[model samples]
Every structure is written in structure tokens, then in C-alpha cells.
Target: MPPTPPEPAAVLARPHTAELTGWGRTAPTASDVRRPTSATELQRALPNGSPRGLLARGLGRGYGDCAQNSGGTVVETTDVDAFTIHDADPASDTVLVTAEAGASIDRLLHALVPQGLFVPVTPGTRYVTVGGAIAADIHGKNHHRKGSWCQHVTSLHLQLADGEVVEIGPDRDPELFWATAGGMGLTGVVLDATFACPRIGSSRLLVDTDRAADLDEVLELMASGDHAYDYSVAWIDLMAGGRATGRSVLTRGRFATAEEAAPAAGPDPYAYSAGVLASAPPFVPDGLLNKLTVRAFNELWFRKAPVRRRDELQTIPTFFHPLDMVGGWNRIYGPQGFLQWQFVIPFGAEATLRRIIEELSASGCTSFLAVLKAFGEADPAPLSFPAPGWTLALDIPAGVRGLGPLLDRLDELVVAEGGRVYLAKDSRVRPELVPQMYPRLDEWRAVRNRVDPQRRIRSDLSRRLGL
Candidate 1:
């Protein structure tokens, strides 16, 4: 008799077939999307030894192919969300929260804030899932002080390829744990995680904003004063040239006290609400965000900001993720989509940063939504992106001509300066340079190979980068 197919209960956990893409909407590919509702279901979902393999996917927030596997299985973890919050841990001083991999940071905030707690780290957007956050080891504006997401993660429950579940953390299987932190899901599927959740007084941020004349002024201000603030970020005018090149608006802040938020926010100091005002139209014409329009917008944005402002009250959404206010914003990039290139260079490499900035400005590249932040330290994860340096993130419409060559030259410069592109946000990095950029790639591969020697766990990104 022929081999039996996977049982209905094993294979049909909300099974479907579709074409999927990351948040950037680039590199779309077909996959079998399986949404397993529980750990037990997920354990039985994968076939014994499928060639295409399986990769876990969360909210699809990554701007690259890390979460996508062409002609393979994409286990959508959204249905596995379950969480519990503990007021205090007897063994430690911090509160404890065990959230399933699928739990989104936005939902966690809704549940935790009422009880006076907040996540230790959050990226530019709260839409990210707990699993995605761990896989990427995301850092936020406050990374200088608190560190990456995995720093706060106490433990993880991972399901291996051979149909076994294992618990790993800093104390037990430290190598595997650290590798999994930013291993891009090559190690195993992260089922759930236990992390420290810090208590907070209010949800508002008391912000101070300063408009710098150029890149030098902005970097100097951040390097000098960033230590005092819990969070800091700068929006650079990439189109500006000459004396005004790299002009930016720097904003820094800390969570507000209940009293500080009362005058304008009224009662319920911990109130949190994020709503989308509008969605970008489904079909934006190609070339709509061309150099002329973007440059004009950049100038207006830079000119309108206050030269300096203090004690400005802002909502969590406004301070961390203004882009969330507009749903389907990616659609604004047109059908061809857009790609986000985020890279970090060590502190002393400011000259290289300046050269890149000059190149972008002179090339007439229109990236109005560019951001610059100062990263304070490197974490233990080998594949983790941040370091003690300056990091810049900007979006480029994929339709732009000659873009590939421009980025290739930029990559060479970045690699020369000991900088690495963020895999979480990358879609076009050269495979040959990955190892050079991440010196510890072999170390991470060793751990991954031990757990998944057959390479049953793979993705488009893993293949592209030869991971």
C-alpha cells in the first residue's frame, strides 16, 4: 500500500493555500499557510520529513523574507496566543508575564496597562508578535538603557523538528537560547516565551523636541544628552543638501507620571487607544512618490517643526509609531511595493555615515521617512543587528531605476566600516557579504545545525543569505 497522507486532525488545523509577502509587500511567494490553534496541534502539524520544511510566521511585520518560505509551509502562529500576568515573582524583583508566541505587543499593552505594567522593549510599531520580536530580538528607542527584547526574555518553549518540545533559557542550553534569540527561526519554532514586564505609572510620554541644523548638530545633541532620556529618536531630512544636509528633528522622552498626564488627558492616566484614521488607497500610481514630491514634503516637514520644545505630552502611538495611524500605508508605495534598508555602524564610523548621507542627498534619492538612532550596546545574539553605534532606517520605492547598483555600493561601504544590515528589514542584501557583516554567523550556524541538522526548518531568507 502507498504511504498514508497526514491525518485530517494533523494536517487540517485551519489549513489554507495562499500567496504571502512580508510587510514590505516585496518578494511575494506561495505557501501552505497552516494556523494551528494550540501547542499540541502545532506539534503534529508538520510532516515527518518534508523537503520544503516549515517556518513559523507571526503578524508578518518583518519587512523581508525571513518569515516566508516559497513552495513550503508557513505556520501562522496567530491562533496560539494565550497569556498570564503575574504581579510579582518570588525569585526576582520584576513582574513576570508568560505570553504565547502569537500574542501581539499591542494586545499585551491593552491587558497589562490597566494593572500598571508595560513591555520592557518595543520597536517602532506594537503590531509585532511575541515570537517575531524574539526571533528578531528587536530593540527600541530606549535600547541604550534597557536593551533588546531577548534581554527581558527569561525563558522560551521551542518545538524542534523531530517532534519534541524543549524549554531553553540563559541558564539551560544558553548557546541554543542565544542563537534562537535572533536566529531568524532557523533553530526551531518558538511556541511561547516568559519575559519580565516592568511596572509603569502612566501610558503617556513627556517629550522634548529639538530641530537640528544638520547631521553633526543632531549627532552631537544625541550623543551628549541621550543618557538622560528613556527614549530617543531623530527624523532626518535625507533630501537636504549642502549646509542643511541631514537636518533632523530629535525627540526624547520618558513615561509620564499620573500627575503629569492629568492636566490634558483627564482621568484614567493609563488610558491607551490607537485607531486608524484612514487607509492608503489600494492602487497608488507608480512614480507617485518620486524625488520632486518627496523632497518637497521633506522640506516642509523640517521647516514646520519647532526649533525647540519642552515637556510636550504625547500618546504612545504618536511617540513610537505614528505610521500605525494610517492603515495600509504600504499600499501607498504602489503595486511594485517598497523596501526598507536599515543598517548600523559603530560609534566612531560617523565619517562613513556622513558619506552615505551625502551620497543619498546628492543622488536625489527620495526617502522622506528616514530615521536615525544611537544604539548603545551589543547583545549576545550572534545574528542580532544593533551595536554600540549609529543606525539609520529608510524606505525606497522598489520601482526606482539604478537602485540595485546604488545599494550594492552602499553595502560595500557599510561592510568596510564594520557595519551590518538588519536582516529583519532587509530584502536585497548580498549573500556573500552576510558572513563578513556578521562575524559570528558560523557560531549561530553550529547551534542551528545541532537542533535541525536536516535543515527541515528553512525560509526564503535563509536560502537567500545561505543561512
Candidate 2:
């Protein structure tokens, strides 16, 4: 589908009411959506402790219910999208920009890439908003090198439950700031943020691609050589069995310098384009992606990757957000939707990782999207998801038989090994395991209590997990 046309100003000014669902499309809820055009308007729309609570929703990129508040007020921040870029600091070689929470990363990229700059951290897709990035403390392929998105953020204005906007940062008000980072917007609504961006020579990346034979080889390859690249990730094939299980295509990259890219640069050495190339059909049958079909697709995909390719040039979209090209791709899973299960196990828990992949392969649940990456240090946010470990994420048809028990069992194994699932991508995790997964839950709750004393800011995720 083509993008929705911009609404007329008068019509845009009116409040919106709609049924909302997260990116996963598994859970849907009715909400009164308040599209505030400015920070002042956002503050005015504050719930004042509504019984159903309120949530600040961004571009709706969170895979789960973190952005949805059932039967409550949802403050959609996309209208407050405006940003101003500043000159780079010569000493630090970093440029700073203050962007309203509603601005999508795609918007920022369009403005920055041509100027030879890029966001310090990006998740798999660039469709998320600045506030959504900070809220999730999102990580990327370079997590082993630069860490999560919140680390680059300098300061932000957060509107508390009482509509009082406060400036907070790592040093100024570290407690509240960190609490809000990865806190899933429970503390307050983020209005705007000033973050540091790294300078880039071109909008292309010099990437190296390698095919790993199996689970063991892929793990060894990433652990031994990932330090050489600024970004690294592996597409693992969980359907492969026995000796070929976990066979993967590992791709690692560093930004291509202007000199290296000029040969094919045409007029603009830093030209960038990330427009969607295609859209998935509006509807698909639930059983279209069964184990047999997935296995065949996996085989084809695996075979298509080069066994060893070095320093190949690729655009930012191709390297970082290939999925963005296919709009509404999630609908391919059919009306039943799909569940994205993402979890991180500590560095020493490689055996657990192998076991999980093994179990999933045996489960017969179809999953074409599965990736493995190495995570470095965790951000100081009490609720930050990443840690020094290996994080794996995959999508599975929600209607898979015995899927519940299968994931439930995996949760115990993860907790036993001191790991936790990513809340942003979760849909069906049990509430009781939350504390075990996030040990600093109480510390975060304390800060949340001070900011939202009446618990005015609540999301379906918070209510579900009792955050």
C-alpha cells in the first residue's frame, strides 16, 4: 500500500479514536488517541490519573504491547515531529541534535545522511521514533562496539504524571533518566531528546560476508573476529538439523570512507535512499509458512549467500534495514499474526543458546527471520535488556501447536542461566518471570513511583508484567 496522505490541518487537529495493535499484530485494543502537535499540547493531554491509565505511543514499532493501553488514553507523539541539527563539535568529532520524541529515525536519516552523519545506534529497522529508541534502549549489529541507543543520548525532557516537564540525563538526574531508559515509558512521556551522532564519510558500508557451517562454527567465528568490524550479525537457520543445525550467514561491516566509495558515487558521495520497494499483500493464509515451506525457503536463502565475500559496498538500507523495503511484511503471517521471541543469555551460556535453537528446530514452528548477535556491556538503565552475552531473536507463527509450553520451558532455562527476554518484542511471557529476568525491577519501580505517584502513565505491557 502507498503511504497514507498527510491529513489536512483542521482534520489533523481533532482527536483520534482507534483500535491499536503493536507491530506483532497479536494483541489489539481500543484507545482514545490524542495526537498532540507540540510539547505544550502533549502536556495538556496528560491523563491526570485516568483509571485506565495512558501511554505515549510513537511509530508503533515495538513488537509487543509496550505502546498500547487498552480502554485508555494513548498520546500519539508523531505530530510533534520536528528537529534541529547543530554544528559538529571539533574536539569530540560528534554532532548533536535536539529532536522531538515523535520524529522517526527515517526522517532523521534523510536529513543526516546527505550531510555525512548517522545515528550512533539503530535497531534492525529505521522506522522507529527517537522516543521509542530511548524507551527500548535499542541495540544493533554494532552493540559489541558502541552499545545501545540510550548511551548516546545526552539529555531529554520528560513530562511527568503531573504534566511537569523535567530535563534529565546521565549526570543531571541519572536515576530518573536511567529508569526511563528501557523502562517502557512507565516513568513518563518523553517529549524531546538531544543525542550525539557520529560523522560518516558516505552513506554506504564496506561489508564482509561469510557463511558458517553450523552452530559451533558461527559462534566461534563471531567471538573470535567480531572485534575487527564495527557491526556484525548472523542469520541463523534453525531448521537445519544434526551437524548442519544453526548454519548461518555472518555479515560484518565498517562504514565505507569517501575515497573507497567515490568510484561509484556519481554526483553525491553521500547520497541516501531508503524508500520502501514493495509491500506484502494485505492478507495471507495462516498455514502458508509451515515447516516444510520454511525449510525450503531457508535452504534457498542459505544457498543464495556468498560463501565468502569481502569489502562489498552496500547502501545503508541494504545493510541495516533490508526488511524496511517490504512494507507490511508482518501480514504475511496471516490473521493469527506472529510472535517475536528475543532473549539474551550471558556470555558463558552458549550451551543454553544451542539448546534453545535445537528445541525450536524440533518444534516445527515456522520462522524465516532469525538472527544472532554478540552483545557487549549493558547500559546503566536498570531495565536495559542487553548485557555481555549473545542475543538471538526470531519470529514464529503464533498458532504453532504446543508453542506455549515450548516457550514456557525455554523461559525457565533462560532464567536458570541468568538471562532475560526482550520486553519490547515479547507478547506471551509469564508475568511471574519478569522479576527473575530483570533483577533491578524494584529499583526501577522506586523511580517510577516518584515520577508517576498515582501510576497515571501505564502501558498494556506494564499492566501485564506488573512493572
Cα TM-score per model: 0.95, 0.97
Please list the residue runs of candidate 1 whose C-alpha ends up more than 4 Å from where it truly belongs after superposition: 1-13, 47-49, 89-93
* C-alpha lDDT score of every prediction, in listed order: 0.89, 0.90
With a 3 Å backbone cut-off (N, CA, C), the pairs that clash in candidate 2 are none
Lowest-sum lDDT 10-residue window in model 2:
7-16
Model 2 lDDT per residue over 9-79, tens place = 76557666688888988889888877889878878878543578888999998888999998888988998
lDDT of 1 by residue, 265-303 (tens): 788988888878889988898888888899889889988
Clashes of each: 0, 0
